[model samples]
Target chain A: MSLSISLAINGQPLDVALDDPRVTLLDLLRERLFLTGTKKGCDRGQCGACTVLVDGRRINSCLALAASLDRAEITTIEGLAEGETLHPVQAAFIAHDGFQCGYCTPGQIMSAVGLILEGHAGDDPERVRELMSGNICRCAAYKGITEAVLEAQKAIADKSGAEQNRRDAA
Target chain B: MNRFDYVRPASVAEAVAAGSEPGSAFLGAGTNLLDLMKVGVARPGRVIDVTRLPGLDRIEWLPDGGVRIGAMVRNSDLAYDERFSRSFPAVAEALLSGASAQLRNAATVGGNLMQHTRCAYFHDLASACNRRVPGSGCDALEGENRLHAVLGWSEHCIATHPSDFCVPLVALDAVVEVEGPHGAREIAIDRLHALPGATPEQETALAPGELIVALRLPADAAAFSRNARYLKLRERTSYAFAVVSAAAMLEVEGGTILRARVALGGVAAKPWRAPEAEAALEGAAPTAQAFAKAAGLALAEAQPSGDNAFKIELARRIVARALTLASEGTPAAMPALPASPFSTKIGANHVA
Candidate 1:
């Protein structure tokens, strides 16, 4: 049966008509919305190539049903930037060479951002590597990925700290 | 994937009513069900989305000092909850050791318990699997039986239940709360899963349209809060299923064990409890020899296939090590996997 859902994708309101209830969130994003930044690697939860934020939590979009997410706030790879400026995770990945083929880069950055927001990306590189095992980099760019996650975490922390300091001074 | 009608119910009664329809399934995280549906392993005509049901997602503390964890509680939230982690560290450790961060964030407690096996034959449509298709033969019994069961397996099926949460729940003596057409009822964790006997199709003990509501830990289980350990032996360091996992809980008083609970996973159709081992440990000193003897009794009836004979020995060692770690109040270190004859290291020259 076809259903209608209204949700926010990357901070933009979207009203999607489901042709089939089995349509996955990944397909809805890539095919329906034309947001092709999210890659479908395994189409299974095994590989986190379809990672996206639903209500600020990272989940595999390939396994999630688009119709089930009626009013959820979704953030895709395209939503990470502010006009011309890239998110810290995206910038850190470029600086640290966190990608080789760049297919899994979007998922990796989204997962790293979720990790930092979830309070998992601490100062320990080993912890970061373990937590990021969901997002597989077939190119084996794990060394750079781990470094970039830690760097992005520090950058985010510093920016928040400076903001808090400015607020206090004001 | 086949076409299916989806309904997001607002309340538990509506969810249960929707689930009563024939060829309907309750959808939780869709981490496993959606994948199986994509591969044609499961074909449901309708899916009831219970994710939005109110009051089923919160973790509450009972007046008896036990925890009542809602079925919709995400695996990551349960693992990271301060009260749950402090009260049941072994459960948190087991949850963290099973899946990746993304999966844990999506999977729920009820969905984890209702997850099917990771048996390759069961997932492959081309292969003959009795569990997937009744009257069909099980190919895993004779072909690539390394990941098959070493206990509680019959000629019809040899699939192992792939659940890390079940091992610790069995050890903690948890109770499963369910609501069905009849009424609300409670089932012991050990009685929740059935052995793969003649009818491998019947996996759980729940009746049709019985939805799992929550899991309740016993109040008396607080005695094991400090002296429990979960040890999972996997082929890789992380994000892999267990080869042999053990959850051990010991209640000691002055160097003597007052009570003991042990359960094994990845080697049986369900979480296999070691009752003889627990009985033998009571009133005995928590020593290496005592643990070894208890572990031996636990695997006395293990019947293994040709390729999975090694799991019997592996489970014995894991049970002993887990008991020792629990008695000493120390966390178990990740165990190194046994070197397979076909294993080879990737050389730098091979990388492009």
Candidate 2:
């Protein structure tokens, strides 16, 4: 039997054709849809390399079956940038030098984005470490990862304030 | 992996019927099942995904002030839910202690409860595992029993329940609600797992066609031990199996133990509740001597292996320390795995 699902990906409505029930959302992205930015260091959930957002929640795409996400909205690493400008989180990673080999960069960015959007990321390093402990880096760049998230927090705060001031003026 | 039929039922009845078939598995989180499938530990012909079932994704408060956690509720959501933190702090703490944020986001409550053992012998296809194949024999018996079970182990199997959530759930007296061909039936949390006495093949009590709907827990003052703590002694800090974990629920009324429930992890085949230890502490005054004695009673039945003799001693110290902290109304100072995890450093400042 075939299953059809309507998904909202990157703010665009998509009707994806999925054939294999065992093929995970990670497979659907890299193998089927050519959204190869989401790296698959480990197809298992241990490595947070396949991070993505489903209905605004961060998940390991490697662990998520595409067939189960019927009408959910998804956001991928490729979808982080709007038009040509990078999302604040992505830019923060770049500005803070969050990665060495950059294989884990996308997953890190996606996870950070989810944390920021969910309002779980705080100024405390331990909180960030505890929350971001799932994504493993081969280079062992946790200090950079923490700094990157902190830098993003600052950027997000600044942007919110600027927007609030604009609203006040209006 | 191999191809399989997938069904996402919007209701409980449809899921129960689909799951009761000959070769099908309930897919909640898909974190463990799908990974195990890829590695060939689990190979189901059909997967009935119950995540979309309308009523199964909620956390409803029972009229008695207890809560029924839906099977499909995500672990991340449960860990962060304000209501859970207010009523069941230990439950939320245990959930957060298990996996990372992203993994927890994908892991469902039911799947975490039903996770298979972390024994390497069981997972590797090449090895002879009683779990993977019924009569192939347990390779861990004669092999590396370091991380294997010492308590509640039989000749047929030696493995530990890997989930961090079940320990707190079991101590809280949770009830597992299931739906099958006959209808729905509620099971005590203690009965969900069976000792691997003769049949290591049968891990959980869920029958062929049964689907877990939700877990209902009763309010117990012991489970809300503000002094309650989750101690996971793993090889690494994050995303590792428990080496010798303990969940302590201690209650002291005027310096005497009114009630206390001590449960151990990574030492037994299931989320082991220590009745002998609990009995020992019932009337004893809350002190170091009493706590250590209770720990000794709890570990009296432990049958450790050559590689893990330290675990027994370490287990005693951990249990004692956890009890003492909980009794004194102090937050448990999370025990760190010895600086030399793979060595014989084997002491946590407090003598075992």
Scored against the true structure, residue A141 in model 1 reaches a CA lDDT of: 93
TM-score of chain B of each: 0.93, 0.91
Which of the CAPRI classes, incorrect, acceptable, medium or high, describes model 2? medium
For candidate 2 chain A, the 10 contiguous residues with the lowest summed lDDT are A121-130
Native-referenced DockQ of model 2 = 0.50
lDDT of 1 by residue, B1-352 (tens): 8888898988888888889989999999899999999999999998999988888898999999999999999999998897787788778878888788999999999999999999999999999999999889999988998977988899999999999989989988999999988889999999999998999999999987899999999887777877887888887667888898898889999989999999999988899999999999999999999999999998999988649889999999989988987887733321111111111121111122
Q: Give lDDT tens digits, candidate 1, residues A23-110.
A: 8999999998899999999998888999999999999999999988899999999999999999999999999999999999899999
Best by TM-score: 1
Query: What are the per-residue Cα lDDT tens digits for candidate 2 across B252-318?
Result: 6777777778887778778888889989988888888988998898899888743777888888877
lDDT of 2 at B153: 84
- For candidate 1 chain B, the 10 contiguous residues with the lowest summed lDDT are B335-344
Candidate 1: Cα lDDT at B58: 88
